[model samples]
Target: MTTKKETRTFNIENLNTRDGGEGESVIGGYAAVFNSPTEIGGGCFTEEIAPGAFSRAIAENSDIRALFNHDWNNVLGRTKSGTLQLSEDERGLKFEVTLPNTSLGRDLKESMQRGDINECSFGFIPTEEHWDYNVEPAKRMILEVDLFEISVVSIPAYEDTEASVIRSKEVNEQVEKRMNLIKKINTTLEAI
Candidate 1:
């Protein structure tokens, strides 16, 4: 089975760019916040990342990249090269990307400093998740993930019509299936 990769973007208030000695620029921020609920698929469901979700992936030393707008061609940093550093702290997955001395990097740094870009995103494949169908719109707790990349983005693209519709359908199906199983269990108990 092919694993579907998902991307989540957050409006990070603390995302900042600073000089990294020798006039080099660095951008840093929390890519994913722990226990923060975010509405997904046009409010069809809510999703949140659980603490330690990236622990295993980080411990395994996954070669993740830091990109601009999730565009591979606009690569900024890589974990393997020491340009991208990732850590899971109490708040969430924090990252620091040493901006390259290139046109793309320089432009990104200027944009971030000007507050034109203050959002961060991460791409990952969910390894473990818990869904709560009892909730009104349903909730998904991402317990673990195989992280691939983090990006400093100007806009969030998760709400594109076609993608949202497809995800909403998948979430609704899961909720319905679980609800049926729950009803069957309750009925069996009442008959006992």
Candidate 2:
């Protein structure tokens, strides 16, 4: 009948990677995270390539799209949408998600497309470039772009071991409540 809440607070930091601060949207920008909650561990954050930045990067970086254009009949599309690539070392992974799937979309898919949807590059380089949402590698990176969910645990450096146990109990309780809520909603819908 009683519950305890987590003391941890998540601060979502958003950054533009491709911005030159030139005051022109055409000048473009790259939206990547430079910070994350300390509990996420060191050097971990998410990287969201600006909406058109990936295609633009592919357009500007090289003619990588040209190859796909020729192969797929110019459907080269969003250079990053539904795209994911990992370094040979497997320590980092970069991919694109539909804009509607990310935090910024209000989650609407109508605006989610190759050009408008965000090109996200997620990585887990502990001592390397961290754009928010970066965390340790989850499963091996897949080739196609699809919705993704990753989970990571961070233990405070100064926590008493018992505190972690208590925190864990709170987490489990929260998960159970969410599940129960979903179950109740499903039951109500069935009755309708």
Among all windows of 10 consecutive residues in model 2, the one with the lowest summed lDDT is: 144-153
* Tens digit of per-residue lDDT, candidate 2, span 1-192: 122211221111221222113321111112222222232212221122122212323333321221110122322123344322211112222222222223332222222222343232221111212121122311111122221121111221312447646655664455446556667887899999
What lDDT tens digits, residue by residue, belong to model 1 across residues 1-192?
A: 116787889987478788999988998989999999998866767899999999999888558899998888999999999999999999999999999999999999888888888998888889999888767677889999999999888897652448756866886677767777877887999999
Q: What's the CA error at residue 101 for candidate 1, in Å?
A: 0.9
Could you tell me how far off, in angstroms, the CA of residue 115 lies in candidate 2 after the best superposition? 49
True lDDT of residue 104, candidate 2:
31
Cα error of candidate 2 at position 53, Å: 19
Q: In angstroms, how far off is 135's CA in candidate 1?
A: 1.7
